[model samples]
Target chain A: MNKILKSIYMPILAVIIAIIIGSIIMLVTGFNPLAAYASLFIGAFGTLPNIANTLANAVPLIITGLGVAIAFNAGLFNIGAEGQYWIGAIVATWIGYSFKGLPWYIHIPFALIGAMVAAGLWGGIVPGFAKAYTGAHEVITTMMMSYVAIYFSHYLLEFGPMMEKGSVPQSPLIKDSAIIPTILRNTQLSYGIFIAIAAALFVYWLMYKTVWGYEMRAVGFNQRASKYAGMNVPLNIVLSLSLSGIFAGLAGAVQILGVQHRLYDSFTSGYGYTAIVVALLAKNNPIGVVFSALLFAALGTGSQYMQLNAQVPGQLADVITGLIIFFVAADKIIEVLKSMFKKQKKEELAS
Target chain B: MKEILLNPQLWSATLAMATPLALPALGGTFSERSGVVNIAMEGIMLIAAFFAVLFAHLTGSAWLGLLGAIVVGMIVAVIFAWAAVTLTADQVILGMAINIFASGFTAYLLNTIFGFSGTPTDTPMLPNINIPVIKNIPFIGQILSGNSVIVYLMIILIFASNYFLFHTNLGLRIRAVGENPEAAETAGINVIKLRYLGVALSGLFSAIGGAYLSIGLLNSFSTDMSSGRGYIALAAMIFGKWTPFGSFGAALLFGFATALSMQLQNSAMSKNIIMMLPYILTVLALVGVGGKSVSPAADGVPYTPKK
Candidate 1:
């Protein structure tokens, strides 16, 4: 219980620091940070439409973040989520546009399965290489895979046979039957949000309530010990990574099916990477991933408003988000903050 | 065949393409040898590329830009080194953060400075210097003759790095630190300082690669121009198993892939699949070489001295 409280406290504190720093930056740039924050808050919850848009952005972020979280929990750094996400979208787009589907349910599941399988293989490759071969670090391999996936996705959209012949760098629109119907009347939020929520719950169960999860977590805690305990550490590592890939692939599938309804080059637009920060801030927990995803989604979605209203570049959101991750990752900073708070409380008591 | 073999321009261009990757790979070998992963080379190169163009545009001299980028690159590398070394953060995550920060920061800098996000100033770019006697030489001369001074520097650095790593006492120390820092410290070496030096060298080499991209290759700075070359260099570093010559060979393969892809785009051949060749080759290499090599024993483990 105390550990859970600390987990919650740490992330909350990180956000407070991020906002304070963002305010200083806003002041230096001659804009009222309060006003910006107000606008951001309003933009996030202003209307049903605003809420829908925010949720729309959150869905894929949640999925991708959960994917990263699972890998991180397994002590395998899977930075290849970007590549997996791209491959997922690529595979989904191929199926959505190419395959003439029967019913909406069948078409959607087929594309989703296609995405999950593709991303899983993409994610699985690094661990397979790492486990079987030179003990090559997954971090480097995954990072490289991110580039490969990005370039491959871009090529598939533009130059491949799947390219919409008339478009410069885009794919054919998905069949109407394949589209995930929107939840709100006039927003991009769709059934994918529910899917993301379902995945979050499912993954939580897998990690905390399953035998496989126990074995994987055991490996994460101590590979040597797990090996001695008769667990196949390499297989668990590969399986965990593959599961992460599946979630990332779902992120891609949802983006196409629920939001864009068509595939374009560079469509996911660094969501996989951003999701890493989200996962870390959430402490690699599924429930935490949901709220963190929403928080980041708010920042991302609010950037559009900030851009339209103020002279500030929308990249301000990225700056704030990056700073948050940097601060959170710096455990020293958190320790310092805790000490500072303790000192302040002592001073108050003395007074 | 003789004419093709004898063409200086072909050799120079090929060598030029190979040099950028080579410099970064050589630098990477140092860090890897010291058992510190330097995947942040891509971000370092991007930062260097930005500063190189910025300083060159400000000072009207490519050399100043080169110097400026080197300085900035050192600062960026120090950030990476501090994170992985002092803070003991996850090296890969720190690297990814730096890369993301570089992309966003460069984009912001472009927007604020030049009011554009695509390409910065259309000002004067780097000029190729033609050596007097070298330009007049046969095929070898032509291949080496008309490039920037930096290309020559890279060639020298290659042999210099090879000698430094295999022959020098310091090289052995760097290798020892990577293999077992605790043991290296027991032998009276300053593991921190050596790691710092190794990371700094990584910055210097990455900056050179950045300059090559901006001043040598494209002749101007463009947004996110380093693309994924830094990652490719990381691949090369691993594919080469922390050796300068091996890394050079790996980088040449990437260069060849890139050069072929660019060439295919211009030709009437099957350009679509050709463009995908580098990434495909990257996957193949990662799978192929990733299985057979051995990395440094202490690679990616931050060395903290006994308290």
Candidate 2:
């Protein structure tokens, strides 16, 4: 219980501090902070529809956050989640459009699997191989690969086989069989949230219960020591990154199969980048990612209302998100302050 | 293909495109050489680009806009230095946050101040300086003359940076700190101060690059006008093996690829395919060259003074 509380404490405090700072920014920008924040709160949770929308927005974030968390646990920074997401969407779109007259169960699973495999191979295995065999840094390699994925997807959507009949740079709609059913009426929320939750649990089990997880953790803790202990460092690196890609790819598949139902240009909308902050805020814990994803999703969903009702720009949400990440990244500030307070209390007692 | 390769106009366009990349790539050389990985160049460029246009519009002076951008860039760099140096935070994460912050802040400010998502036209632009005798001198002149002052400055910077990194005492100290902070400290070098200086200079150079994009090459700023050039500069930095001249060459190669793509846009092939050239080339360059490049020994590691 104490451990759990300790884990939760810093993130909670970070969010509170971020909100206060955000309010100050709003006020300085000549907007009513209270009204803006209140409306934002109401817009995110005022009705069942609002709540569902927020959850729907969160599904991809949670999955991608888990992806980032897993890789970070293995001491790898997988910044290519965006690329993985794109490739997954492209593969899922191909399967969705090409297949016809198939049962829903078969087609949906096929698309999802295709997304996971293709993206895992391209975004995860290839970079992992580079890092393992050639000593390439994952940060630069993943970023470069992301551009390849992005433009490759752009080529496929705009000028390649998947191009729709119209001029719009998007794929034709997926067959109804591939669509993940909507769970809530009058909202974009779908049953994908259940899949996200299940994946979160699976990640938790994998990172904590499995032998591979133990080896990966050991390697992350100390590569030389793990190699000395007979762990295959290169293989663990590859496996860890591949696992990260799998979750990121699943996020793309869910977004396409569950929400968009087609491959569109620039569809991921920085979900991959945002996942970095989510994982960080969660301290790279899979379970914590779910809650952090929800918080961000709420902010995202409410920002539109904040724009329309309070005359604030929707980008304000992004600013707030950045602030939260900044505060969280500087979490040592909180630790230092806490230590200082303890010292002060001790002096008071002595006096 | 022969005509395209031999055309002076193509070379000129490549050089023009290369200038923006070379500036930041050179800046990154200094920062990384001092053992501070500046992944926040993208965010710095974006914020500076926005301020460049805003100041140019307000004061109607392009030079003042450039100054404003540099000041803003240095301010942002100070925050980054404080976080990465003073707080000893993870440099990569902090860099990413700053990038996101710059993007969000610029967009929000544009909305509030400009009352629109994009920069308005009628903003003053920096004038191209045509070197009189040199500009009249045939094919060489076509490639070098009649470009903005920043282009000329970029070339001068490359030579200046090479000198500063290899020949100067301060350069030796910066390299010493990057190679081994403890040794540098033992030698009585102020490692922290050198690092802060390195990072601040990087911010200054990248801001000038940003200003060039906003007012030098184009008349006004658009949302996301920098458009991944910062990342490309970083790739160039690595591909060049963290040397100023090497980075300049890499930047030129990327620029040439972009120029080739633009040349192909008029052909029967799809524009999208042509547009992928630079990005594809970047990936190939990294795959081929990345492993060969060695970074500073203590790059990206925070230095905590031993008490």
Candidate 3:
């Protein structure tokens, strides 16, 4: 119980501090903080439609956050989820549009699974192999691969095989069989939210209830010790990154089949960095990713309303997000401060 | 291919394009050599680029703009150093957060202050310097001289950095600290202080690179004007094997690839495909297509002194 509270309390404190600072910035910049925040709050959760929209927006973030959390749990800094998302999106689009006359169940499953497998292989083959074989840092290699994937998508939609024959650079719409139904009428919300939540549950099970996860976590804790204890360290590294790619690919696949319905030129997830923050906020807890992702999603949605209603730039959300990351990343300092406070209290009691 | 290779503009463009990458690549070399992984050059460069134009627009002096950028850059470096060194946070995460923060902050400021007209068109620009002696030489003069003033500054800084990192006691001590902090601490060396100095130097040079983009290469700032050059500089840092001269050479090569892509834009082959050369090459370089890249022994590992 104490351990759980220790993990939960810091993020809450960090979020509160970040919001207070954000309000201070607004006041300093001559904006009415109360009005801005009021509109922000309403825009995020005031109405049923607004809440639905927030949850809809959170679908991609939740999936990607879980993807990032998986990598984080294994002590891997996998910033290349953006690239993996791209690869999955294109693969799903290709599979979605290519096949015809198939039932919805067969077609959807086929496309989704295909995307996950290919993207998983991509994550394993490129950065994973490079890191395992040549000792290349995944940070550089994965980021480079993201550009490669993004540009590859651009090439495809612009004039390559996937381009629809129109002035706009985009792929042909997915077949009707492959399309995901809308969960809420007249809103962006889609049935993909269920998949996203399922992914979180799946991740929790995979990371906690399985033997593979145990070995992976052990390797993450101490690679040398794991190796000495007869674990295949390199395989675990490759597997951890591959699994990260799998979840990221699922985000892309679901977005394509459910939301985008087609591939467009210059297509990018744009959730790469945000998802990392979500994972960090949740402290890599799979279940906690849902709440953390929702929180960020709310900030994004509310800030847009804040921009329109209060004349405050939505970019303020990003600034606040950054401040939260600072406080969270400096968690050791928070621990130190807590210890100092505890000591002072004890001294007071003694006196 | 032969005509493109022999074209003088291509070589000069290589030099022009390389100044941005080389400066920051040199900066990365310093930061990582001191054992702090700084992926925040993109953020540093973006913030500095904006401030560079802001100051230049306000004062009508490009030099003053450069000074303002350096000051802001050093302040950011201090925060980064304090976090990565004192707080012993994850340097990579710190870098990423700062990158996101800088992007949003600059965009918000631009929207609020400039009202979306963008920076003033008449913002003062750093003058190109014509080397008097070299202008007489054919072909070589155009490639080496008569470039942006920052290009020349970058060249000088490269030579200065090469010497300082190798031939000085302070430089040796910095490397010693990065290689083994505990040993350095045991030997009466201040590990944290040296790391701060090293990271601060990165800020100084990255500021120059960012300022070069806004006032040195162009007259004003635009959103995300750094355009991933900071990451390219990281690639160059690795390709060049983390040395000043090597990074310069690698930057020139990558710059050549970029210049080549620009030249081939009018050709029949896919332009986007050609644009991907540098990125793909970056991957190849990392997978040992160029050579095996090595890092400092303690690079990216936060050092918390044993209490």
User: What value does the interface RMSD of model 3 take?
Assistant: 1.8
Select the stronger candidate by DockQ from 1 and 2.
2
Model 2 chain A: lowest-lDDT 10 consecutive positions: A151-160
Q: lDDT of all the models against the reference? A: 0.80, 0.87, 0.87
Task: Please give fnat for model 2.
Answer: 0.50
Question: Could you give me the TM-score of model 2 versus the true structure?
Answer: 0.95
Q: Quick one: best DockQ, which candidate?
A: 3
**Ranking, DockQ, top scorer first:** 3, 2, 1
- Tens digits of lDDT, candidate 2, B81-152: 888887888888888888888888888888888887478798888888899899989988888898899999
Docking class of 2: medium
**Minimal lDDT window, size 10, model 3 chain A:** A264-273
Best by lDDT: 3
In model 1, the clashing pairs are none
Residues B1-307, candidate 1: write the lDDT tens digits. Answer: 3554455554566667777788888888998888788878888898898888888888888788888999999998988887777777777767776777676666666665666544445544566668788778777676767787777788788888999999999999999999999999999999988998899999999998998788767757776788777877877776776888888887777666565544545432344455455445544555554455567899888878885
Give the chain A TM-score for each candidate.
0.94, 0.95, 0.94
Q: In order, what DockQ does each candidate have?
A: 0.35, 0.56, 0.64
- Model 1 TM-score, all chains together: 0.91
Q: Please say which candidate is ahead in lDDT: 1 or 2.
A: 2
> Which residue ranges in model 2 land beyond 4 Å of their true spot?
A335-351, B2-8, B266-291
lDDT of 2 by residue, A166-270 (tens): 878789999999999999888989999999999999999999999998888888889999999999999999998888888889999999999999988873468
